[model samples]
Target: MKKILMQLKDYYGEYLLLIALAIVIGLIVGVVDAYFGMILLKITEIRSLSPFLWIPFLPLVGLFIVFMYQKYGKTSSQGMGLIFEVGQGENKVIPFRLIPFIIGGTWLTHLFGGSAGREGVAVQIGATVAHTLGNKLNLMKFQTLLIVIGMAAGFAGLFQTPIAATFFALEVMIAGKFIYPALIPALVASFVASTTSHFLGLEKFQVYLAEPFDFSLFHFLLLAIVGIIFGVVGSLFAKSLSILKSKMAMWFKNPYRRVFIIACGLSVLLLLLYQGRYAGLGTNLITASFSGQHIYSYDFILKLIFTVCTLAVGFQGGEVTPLFSIGATLGVVLANILHLPVTLFAALGYAAVFGSATNTLLAPILIGCEVFGFEHFPSFFIVCAFAYFFNFNQSIYGKQQILK
Candidate 1:
């Protein structure tokens, strides 16, 4: 205990710095997330007011995203690939020029009814801030750790799951090895960021559930089965997106043409499925997941199709949020089939499938506990472990390396 206390005292200054940085990053991320959300909401409203006018122009939005990438997104290197590059010994600092491109491209994607998540945009912004700070301060390896911490901070600030965000930053890069030394900094940053976001009145995602029922043997078996199904669904989702991306690359020699093709395809599909549902980030579906209401048995399949196409088409966003929407809805459907509690199964599905898809175990379990409460911790851990192993090396971020 004395040794531990001394170590804590020694690292107190570093912890304080991380906390301060996290607060600033979190506030920035929170404002960006909220602002982007509001902007998307306005664009959505505009499309609603005149679908004929907006729908016809949707393909142009895709073209604009392609144009932005051709012009200014060269430094991004595509999606989270750039993050891995920085983490794995590349001095390829994220330029501030890429920030506007990411924010603008993502906003336009959603504005024109592209299906994607906001977390990707927020994360890139957070990392950019850290990278810029590191460059300006000329900090060494220790400062690079701040880049990772900033990722956790941004994610926590946006999602309001600080603990999960901490682990996510640690877990996202490699499997089987936790970066134990970074834990203190990551956690401190996450807490500061989450606190800052809350102070700024950004709301956390909410779920309604009855008390967790007793963990019966039968229920556990049933959940395990549901987890297995989720594993398959999640794996398929990841594989399909990868395949589509590859195929698109092969089909169009021009990157812009590939994006245009995807946009046009999505427009046609959206028109056919014109409920004005399953468009954009699918936040409505995530909200409905908790209630286990209004979700058809096939909702997951539809979401899977739309998300795969949207992401495969080269739009900017993270897969985790859409995965959450897919998992929760599927869990509800599975619960109904197995005669289990809808809310309980939905929560399990949300975490486990996300864990499976992302090749993350603890982060998703923590996410479950953070979002649903500690009472579900044991169940969440069990299900997520099952799903994670069952999926075995599959990942939504294809560039992630499996260490272990």
Candidate 2:
């Protein structure tokens, strides 16, 4: 390694330092993600043991969560918005405290049966850790790059999809721009984080799916149609989230009252409807969509409404998993109507809807190939491309900047 570096006069120890930092950051975030995922799953399992016992207290939990944030959260409560502000250079500092605040808040949300996702927490965890490291090490010039690196590691650590994570972090800050220099560090961090989390016993969700029929012009056109449907649904989910967040804040005014009142209602609705079926990541819907476990036509719509409501009312979590659930369930219903194989269409939805909702093109396509199988790459590409085109540039991240 030293010999190679010596051969290039222009390049010296900077590359080595960057690589070392990426590896260190990845290792640290990977350990954090592994514990975060495990604790969350354990709490969710415990809650499922007696949802009636646990779920009724959602309003109280909501109050506690709000109080915790109000007391110790400070600017951390801005959540992903703070990360974005730093990424876009509008703000510079991401406090050291965001990591615990997000993780603890999300764990409590899941434990109390709030309908939410985990990816947002994962991304924020990564960004905060990496950004803190950069700040301490005086890597001010690469501050934005560190945020991207941390985001990739956090996502990869949680989902075990390094390729998709790298692209997601790279493309997420801007609609049509890429941070070219962060590519190597980001990739290194992602793979290391993914490997570390897997080694620590966090499981990655995967399914094997293939093209239902021979590829033909008819199939291609049909895929385009399906993609549009998923796109519209994804757009609706993103738009509704923004609207609900704004409207709820306007109406309630007080954070404590808002969370408590809404959570009381959500607890009853979540309990009454299928006994906590739409709560905590919507993995039930996703599993049912794939496993043929009696998914109703309204499953997607209800999950969408429940998740948007949960987040809008101050619950903590991410949106990507619920988006995945929505896509998968919607795909199941649509496939039945279109007379196509449910597995194939559901897989398409799992990826395409996420892409559409996040306004990310490559990440979803790559995630499809990674989580499902690369053999379905063409199908994923076709569906994800169409979905991206029809997304109308809506994103669950309120602070995302569209280059176009």
Root-mean-square deviation per candidate = 2.9, 2.3
**Per-residue lDDT of model 2, residues 1-404, tens digit only:** 88776777435366667778999989999999999998988888888778999899999999998999998889999999999999889899889888888998899999999988899999999999888888889987788889999999999999999999999999999987888778999999999999999999999999977444679999999999999999999999999999999999999999999999999999999999989999888887888988878889999999999999999989899999999999999999999999999988999999999999999999999999999999889989999999999999999999999997
How much lDDT does each candidate structure score? 0.75, 0.92
For model 2, the stretches where C-alpha displacement exceeds 4 angstroms are 1-12, 210-212
How many Å off is the CA of 151 in candidate 2? Answer: 0.3
Clashes of each: 0, 1
State TM-scores per candidate.
0.91, 0.97
Error of 2 at 195 (Å): 0.2
lDDT of 1 at 289: 75
Q: Which ten residues in a row have the lowest lDDT in candidate 2?
A: 7-16
* Candidate 1, residue 270: lDDT: 67
Cα lDDT for residue 281, model 2? Answer: 83
